[model samples]
Target: MVSREIRASVHWGVAHALPTVFLRRAAAQGDLQARLIRVGSRGTDEVFDLVEEIRARGPLYRSRIGYVATSHAAVRHLLTSDDFRTGLPTDQGPIGRVARWAAPTTLHPVEPPSLLVTEPPDHTRYRRLVTRVFTMRAVERLRARTGEIAADLLDRLETRASGPVDLVEAYCAQLPVTVIAEILGVPEAERARVLEFGSGAAPSLDLGLGYRRYRSVTRALAQFDDWLGGHLDRLRHDPGDHLLGQLVAVRDEGEGLSETELKATAGLVLAAGFETTVNLLGNGIALLRDHPDERARVVADPALWPNVVEETLRLDPPVLLTGRMAVRDTELAGQPVRAGSMVTAILGGANRDPEVFDDPVSFDVGRANARDHIAFSAGRHHCLGAQLARMEGEVGLRAVWDRFPDLRLETGARRRETRILRGFERLPATLRP
Candidate 1:
């Protein structure tokens, strides 16, 4: 019962496949009390049906979920909900089970035990400790540094041979890594290696790929741990102004974080900080390239970069999915969800929900509610680096446009194979020098 308008706007590209699978799986579960709602290319009709289904069956349901190969809902539900656990035993069998499994050790395992994985106390504790480091004030302080990084990147991009340049590699990918390295106190010379290692650690279920990434992540983690551990020891003797130095000084009645916790926290910050920001920059640039009018508007008024970034997140978020595990059977949106189920909140899909956003498909940089988008997520576990990411996006995009107002996308834009993190692997563009 999806609406024609929504259906018409359906992006039937490869990206839509996986989410569709989850929707279909939920529909096919064969549970009499639970029904799966299908919203096809019919737009409002489909959305209407989806709303009715949610109202009738409740938000949480018990069924063998089938998902569209690339639907946003499928991925979001898989990653962010308690009704579906990514790493747990599921009726989906080996292939299905392995596909969703998230290991703390893996960098990109179709799933991973990130801050997005755990719920309640663990999530609460981790979030509380880390949240302080990424506040608006802290992010504001980093603005100057972020601007410097953006300028350096633009300089590099400008100097590149005037023909088609891979924007993703030349500018998007490098900026965030440099920013993160500076924030984490990693030597500039080591930033590339760290990025390489962090990339390898990302979760990809392909056994060969996953194993290789795991090894790279492990080795990198060891090196980072050793370096940070030594740095912490020194900081205890002589403190500095960086995050790691500050973390070492924090204490709760003389009971501070264990070395393991510190290392894990630092690693998480480093990996999440740079990777997500990089994708955001890349995705935003690509979106502007595709939407010339919007790009022109932003270029004409650099202040609109924030809104542009926000709209880009709503339209094509870098982090496509996030997950949570159910501690007990509960009713969500009315449906009965068993205890220990996984609940995936479809941020991307939800952000685009026609009921929530008017003209959801169009990229409107001036949309009043653009900032309300769930790109940084919601609730207690919302992204700690939200402000930092925004600063990076605003400053980075402004720099790009400022340097080359006539930047145009060349043919052949391919998104990376990593579904969890949605972004371009390569984006060739011509900059008018």
Candidate 2:
């Protein structure tokens, strides 16, 4: 019998390493999609230039791995079509079987039972229960609390000694985590641990991770699963008035999530609750700082704050790309795609589709159609926390500038290395000019 670590290593090799090797060779051969996967932020110009190159190739271009969609219409069709489904590609043959068998049963965003991958009637059931508690009204109610949290976090930043501080860590990450923890009824004391686990596991969303990072991510997921199970068990006995407690109540009172489903749902909620928002906040601050003219416009009129958030999302989305597998033979944007083909949707590229918005690459905070970008995705799998994230972005960003209108973005900002999730890992800035 293979040990758990050995099994996980095999799974990583099959799932990640092989793909990395294929992509590297393809990238060297000038495969645009493969190149996009390997693109970094030495400067974002190269990323966008490659995206435009893919766009120039037409709506749906075939790459070494599979189909690549960069056009707004094509990407929207892929995301919203019933002929396609979400999740990783289904491996075939004996080695593929071993890879699947070796995978440990953990609550992963990409794994089955998690809303990211499940299809109806299970998907419908899980979504309905979660939506009931995580409604628009519920998010609106928390807007005030979110503002307060942002203000408090900025206040702490202001008190720190005058020097370059990593805003991503000190402010961007803290505000949303605090707000989400309050919503989930997670004790304040455990929020730091939650953030640590989230940071460790975040790279799981990216592709082609090295063995060291893969091992660390799997370990984080396993530990997070253990902690989540105990927390859910505690909630079972005393379901409080929080969103997670309500989910527990729903689970106990007849046709609802099983123990495994409950853990998966709750864990996704916890990790996703802040991860993207952290990216959004960081991206917004950087965008505003870089475009000082726009920052001045926002400062002159506070009502434009929400639009700032939308424009930031449009210009630099947290999740750079997502993919869907063809469920059956289908035609997308007049192109024939056979069954079992994978179509990668470059969300960032689609957001810059020249046909959608005039001067698509320009950072216009007042761009009327800024909200039309699918930064949160589309169709059934649209981000469940879209409203919450928008609120956090607006409030968190507004609080930062409101407290210190002359905040200076110092040199040495660094972007997160993950290809899929785009944001700053370190945004050096001084609170006062």
Candidate 3:
């Protein structure tokens, strides 16, 4: 165990600390992307302003880290083009060698076989299995279940003894976790534990953490890994008919994922399945409450609820940005990009590109092109649960307003501090007008 801790420490230095040093220095030198990353978290308006600053520089801004893509066209191209692939540029140095050797073997979203980092072939295979079970039709079928879950949660919210209640804790978080737990066959008794694990492990996607926080995150990850292994083992012995059970049974062509692959895939799906939607629900609720005029517009036109979700996603995305590395020397947005260069696509910024939408930052529920925003990302790496997330966001937010049309946000709503993912950690609100 001591040796494991040593390895993790060494791994953190190479994987996180080294880059953090350069990023902090670059941030100090006024590099917009560097500042954005090094700060780790920022207020909504300020973060957008920083992204716009990078955009104002040109289509692509080069920072000490690599290139940052903010324009709608540039970001779309960076995400969609074959020249760029997901994951950071490989480090082929002695430090890289040591880092790779010291890295933990835990199943994580940033690691291989998780689909987030895996390219074609394996990615195609794993995605195929998941898509078979997580299809749009499958998601659409769950809409009624999702709405039912929202209604049930609101009932609990209504029963709470008065004063400001945290909407994130009572509604936004519970609704999606319950829905996803049902989808993944997680027993109701174990749902809270799953949520805890996801919350603890979420920072694994970010960069540059202090050692104390890093150790905590690593422990959480290991715990989640052990729990999932047990869960999957139980499923293997007596698999049910749910999506994960089907995955366990190797439903697609009988080509099952190995235990590590299965664990990686399941962990990613479980965490990602709810985390982003948690952000989406919270962001949508806050956006609607803050923009009562648009909220009223949607209330009058019940059919616009779906559009409301799209518009919210456009104005304030759940995810801020994603990074990709150039697979080969290539050109992007008329600029030459060399092989191994990294391009950080600021999804939040791209959604607000003036070329795509009018008054890009304003919350417009009726915006016709709101769906054009790539909040779920694009190309081969598009979010597998996009439809499910949209369904949850639409149903969850509408349910809140439908149940309590006069719901008022309190003064203490707080945004989450994770660098890539954005949303509220706590959203205090009054159920009554």
Candidate 4:
């Protein structure tokens, strides 16, 4: 039987989703021994593999927390279904006890809601505001700037002409952060602080942080929020032609955004922008080095870079799993879901579903259906930054490989030790000819 504590915690929005995710994961592994698959204690690379193994066990498996939808059919349906929502149907407050139960037994105040964990109206509105910035037309305008950023980073990496390079730090990590910081018009002096705070708060998306880490994240969020408030205020006073100025205009027009919404939107954009591309660059480069035939093909014909991008996404997406809650009693892939109970949809499994792609396990850049993979997820909740992320990958990957024809892995990468974000902590490589 589910505890009343968890029941309350699970029923809310973005401000509460992390605790709910933590509770469900903890309960799923700790007590609900019904078909325990040992998601806990696995290394970062192994975690996605484990999810894939569960995915192979047919489409839908009833895990302790709601359902684990792994098949292409199941994941796509669950994400797209109107019956499932990112949050509970109601705001139903007084959830302090629930937060304590989710984390350690300590009081936690509600935080600003992110689009990731909000339902329609709220989610739709925020999505509209963000989509205005990332439409293909808008993203296309950034192409020249993004390409220049990528080339500059790669050029710097080339200066290291000899010895191993920590590409994760020197190239992969720096490129996306720089591009996003520029897009937001972040001051040159404050850019480092923004990413530093971003790095601290990022783990809020995963489990096993316990209380201390959660506290640290809360502090970072407040600091980032403070900086964002000032930044947005400045943009409002003198609207430029940048995305920040555009967002400020959105906020000032019509119903306009509340102070909370303004801050949350900026924070969400910053959070969404950085890590996805960084990890994608790291993962894609590493994959290219490991597979020389594919590497040679990609470098030999850079036009195939998009195909390479698609394949890398399908094989190792930056985000491994996403959660959805049942808004009303409904069935997913034949499993009955009760309202408010959450489901963990394993994207890694869905991408590799045999039903969707032939030779699913092996990475095949030429696979016709590579683009079909929902690496950015599906439905209204799909990544708003999808176009931007692809552009970054397209520019970043090809630039590095094309620039350094002899690029290859130097030492082993240190995986992030996280299950939710399947990526690397550091990736080392060589650019010697």
Top-lDDT structure, candidate number:
3
lDDT of each: 0.62, 0.86, 0.87, 0.74
Query: After TM-score superposition, what is the CA distance of residue 188 in candidate 1 from its true location, in Å?
Result: 0.8
> If the candidates were sorted by their TM-score against the true structure, best first, what order would they fall in?
3, 2, 4, 1
For residues 1-433, what per-residue lDDT tens digits would candidate 3 score against the true structure?
A: 5598789889888887887888888889988888888654654557887888888999899887899999889999998898999877655578768867898888778888789999988998888878865678888899998988998898888877277899888888898899988888888999999989988887888988768777878888999999998998888877887878888888333577887888998999899999999999999998898899999999899999999999989889999899999999999889999998999999998999999999998999999999999899999899999999999999998998999998889898888878999989999998984
Q: How high a TM-score does candidate 2 get?
A: 0.97
Question: Per-candidate RMSD vs. true structure?
Answer: 10.2, 1.5, 1.6, 5.4
State which candidate, 2 or 3, has the greater lDDT. Answer: 3
Clashes of each: 71, 0, 0, 0
Candidate order by lDDT, decreasing, is: 3, 2, 4, 1
Put down candidate 4 lDDT per residue, 129-203, tens digits, no spaces: 667778899889889999998887777877786878888778887888888888888877887787787677766
Task: Return the TM-score for each candidate structure.
Answer: 0.74, 0.97, 0.97, 0.86
Can you list the residue pairs that collide in candidate 2?
none
After superposition, candidate 4 runs with Cα above 4 Å error = 1-43, 88-112, 250-254
The ten-residue window of minimal lDDT in model 2 covers 39-48
Off by over 4 Å in 3: 251-254
- How far off is residue 78 in model 2, in Å? 0.8
Q: What tens digits encode model 2's per-residue C-alpha lDDT throughout 127-240?
A: 887775457888888889888888788778878838778898899899989988887888888889899889888888777889998889888998899888888888888888
Give the clashing residue pairs of candidate 3, or none. none
